[model samples]
Target chain A: MSEVVSALAGARASGMVELADAGATGMITLRGDHALLGAAVQAVLGLAMPEVRRVVAGEGAQVLWMSPDELLVITGYDVAPGLAADLQSALGDAFATVAVVSDARALIRLSGAQARDVLAKLCPVDFADFPVGALRRTRAAQVAAAVWRTSDSDWSLICFRSVAGYVWEALVTVAQPGGEVALYR
Target chain B: MLLLTCPCCGVTAEETEFANGGEAHLKRFGPGSDDADYEAYMFARKNPRGVHFERWRHIYGCGKWFLMARCTMTLEVFGTYRAQTSEPPAEIVAKIKARRPEWEGF
Candidate 1:
């Protein structure tokens, strides 16, 4: 099997903001009724179904509520296919649908004091109100993306793998020393 | 830029996060209906200048369809409601009436 490489490998970072690829993270997409889906998630992932636009974290896993009826499961990349299958069988005929989308997206982690400033350059969401665990499905520098605050100064951005290169370049250009994008701060 | 809230996800996102879905509460005139009635159903739309009810999708947010009561003239949003409803909610109609006294219910 050919090894998967991160889209940001060999990319230069501006230092003001630490950019790292959350390498080979597993991702699964699920959609169904809230109650049934929540129950299945709890049974399979041992985590609660997060509130709308929120995240529930467990040991080595995170469940992000993408919508009222949709959720994104994050875990180790190698474990994604098996986890998705396990969830499918556990929730057989109970939920609407489940799919493993691990290879379809690139997960990027941005941290440092200037992280918020860099994100602000891409989307119109008010980061001040985006407290920890808050997730927002919006555009990032013109690409469809979902952003969530992991901690006080850390954020995770997920976007299509195809545009990962563009997104990385945009972030790097904005994070450069005295980078013009920081004006948003 | 219209800012509307998705009732499903409770996210008040910008227009960029939504996709406009034209008029709401459209009644379908299927087979056996008169030609005129079918034409009206397919073509005729009440493009009222004020207090318009329309369908909107929170495509980038919740991926749920919703209804928005807006003013075409002033671009003022009256409110948003779930798309599963066949008609506008009574409370939203009351709000519009309170704001625009000359307006009629949908």
Candidate 2:
């Protein structure tokens, strides 16, 4: 098991912004017939993949609609191991591929009073329409990710594991005190 | 830019994600067809006012071939569905069955 580290520990921007550690979190990929995979995903995660321009939230999980036949599932830091196995079993030969990539992704939670302000400076999506229950599995800053607003003023952003450091540094830079700024990794 | 609705992706992405398939709903020409029919078949299409169905490729995202319904006059895109997605081919069914050796009796 890899040692868990805060996504933004040493990279703090002098009391301006803080980074939430999300390395321990798990990320999974679910692919199949959209309908069948959606059913299996809902059955296993208690959350249905949201429609295009929409999102469905669960207790500790989130389903972002990536494509018509692809979805990115974000589970709790410590979710059930059986979840992936069960999905594989249920999907069986129905899906073209079902990969449990909890370890393949590095999860991060970006939250602060100015989180939205920070995001607005970076992303092109109309954050005005993004609500608490809204999830957008689109690209931000030219990087594909699952962007969601956990609350009216709070948001969560995730990306592939390898680029987590770069994203964290970028977020920290923009989150500095006062106006928008940039940070280094 | 042409707006394409990806049924598989369920999003109306910009034409950037889609590739144009020559013509849609074309019929095969039979032997001894007339010259006029050949001309019409060779280079012609119906430029409709509303509800034009065409074939588009979702190249960037899913890489799945699908059908899209749009309005030519207004350029309003409606819905999309995968090619052969509605029903599986017999060969695909047989291949799937053969690949699943675990499903002996179930």
Candidate 3:
């Protein structure tokens, strides 16, 4: 099997906001009914099922409710393969699916006082109401993305691996000094 | 810009985040169907000037399909509901009826 690699290979840029590849984080996609998914996720990640369009954290893992029938599990890259198998086993013949999607995405971290301003320029989400722990899935410019605020000055984003390069460049350009709109500052 | 919400996930976002799936409650014609039925299913649409129900996909959000009832002329959204049902929910239909007294039923 070929070795997995991040799209940007840990590229970093220092501007009004710090934009860098957060590296290849493991991701597993689970699809099932609520009762079944809740049990399966708890048995495997020990994380509570997140509310609709929400994110829940527990122990060392995070569960994101991607849709009514879908969830995105975030965990260590090395453990993802094994965990996916475990999740499937936990589901146990019920109507559901679990697949490793770590290689299908790339993570980016944007942190600084101006991080919000940079992201607000590209995505259409209302940043003022987007508090910490709130998750939003929208387009950053043209590429689809799911973003969450870790703190007032820090943000994390994940997008398809194919568009990771574009997301990085877009963030870098918008993070340029003096580009700050200060609307979100 | 139209601000729509996905009933499945409860994400209210701008119209750009959704993909319009055309008029809602469409009766699909599959294999062995008559030519007229198939043609109507394929191309015919209700271009009502006032109240309307249409399907929308939260393409950038939850990626779920939902139905929205709104006025075609003003784009005033009446309500949005899950796409699982074969017809608009009674409450939404009633709301539309109350607002547009002369409007035809869904």
Candidate 4:
């Protein structure tokens, strides 16, 4: 097993203001004909359309519903390349179009006591009912993102590459060590 | 929360996702048309205090606009249908009659 990276090192390398990126986590985006995406995603990852809005995550994998038809899926950093190819093959040309966006996003994981509270202050969506295992496709701070709760106290927020640096800076600055903010790698 | 049923997207979504576009089935008088008729068309309206038929757009969902009749006092929703369609659904008519007994069978 690989040794866990130090929180301070993870934060500095990730440059996140809220929470640090484990730096090795893989982020991918799947966009296709909205009608076909649900089944395609289901076939690729054994997950279905996340129906709980911002409060629940899909069972097998951390799936966040980005829109009525769009979704975001997160997994271990090392699994990305193979999964991207598998996803592309599953939904060939029959589905209008299929695009595997493996490198278009920045994946940041925020865990700790103050994670939810800090997210609430940064994003507009109501967090009171946002339960673990749910995915939310909404604006994080002011940027478009797909947020998925991996556990009771941890969440994965994915955003576009352009604003990735900004988001990282914001989370790291607010994330404290002992109480409100904690870094997980 | 107010619920809107879109013809394309079906029955789902909160009122915040939609925009109210005013009364449904109301016709407008052209400038070249008769004067009194224009006056009646422009100024006169159903203005019903009970259930009112209105147009609403599902801005955040399927993006299709629809017409629905809902109670103003009770806020009870009747039914919804496509905006450009010729007539309201029979279910909507039935709901209107059921809610407003005076308009029964009309």
Pick by TM-score: which candidate is best?
3
Q: 3 or 4, which is superior by DockQ?
A: 3
TM-score on alpha carbons, each prediction: 0.94, 0.60, 0.94, 0.54
Error in Å for residue B48 of model 4:
16
Task: Please list the C-alpha lDDT of all candidates, in the order they appear.
Answer: 0.86, 0.63, 0.88, 0.63
Whole-model lDDT for model 1 versus the true structure?
0.86
lDDT of 2 by residue, A42-121 (tens): 78887765876456777787777766667777776466356777778877777456766776655556666566667766
The C-alpha stretches of model 2 lying farther than 4 A from their native spots are A1-17, A77-80, A180-185, B1-106
Give lDDT tens digits, candidate 4, residues A90-138.
7776553434454567777786656676676566545666667666544
Clash list (residue pairs), candidate 3: none
lDDT of 4 at A61: 47
Cα lDDT, model 4, residue B44: 84
Q: Write the per-residue lDDT of candidate 2 for residues B1-106, one digit (tens) a residue.
A: 7766566656455675467885456664666898778778877787665545577876654556776655576675545556764443344334435644342221
- Candidate 4 Cα errors over 4 Å, as ranges: A1-18, A32-39, A52-61, A76-78, A173-185, B1-106
Ranking by TM-score: 3, 1, 2, 4
DockQ score for model 4, please? 0.07
Give a tens-digit lDDT track for model 4, residues B17-101: 5778887887778989899889988888777778788899865444467888888877778878778765677887887877687
Candidate 2 lDDT (Cα, 0 to 1): 0.63
DockQ of each: 0.73, 0.17, 0.79, 0.07
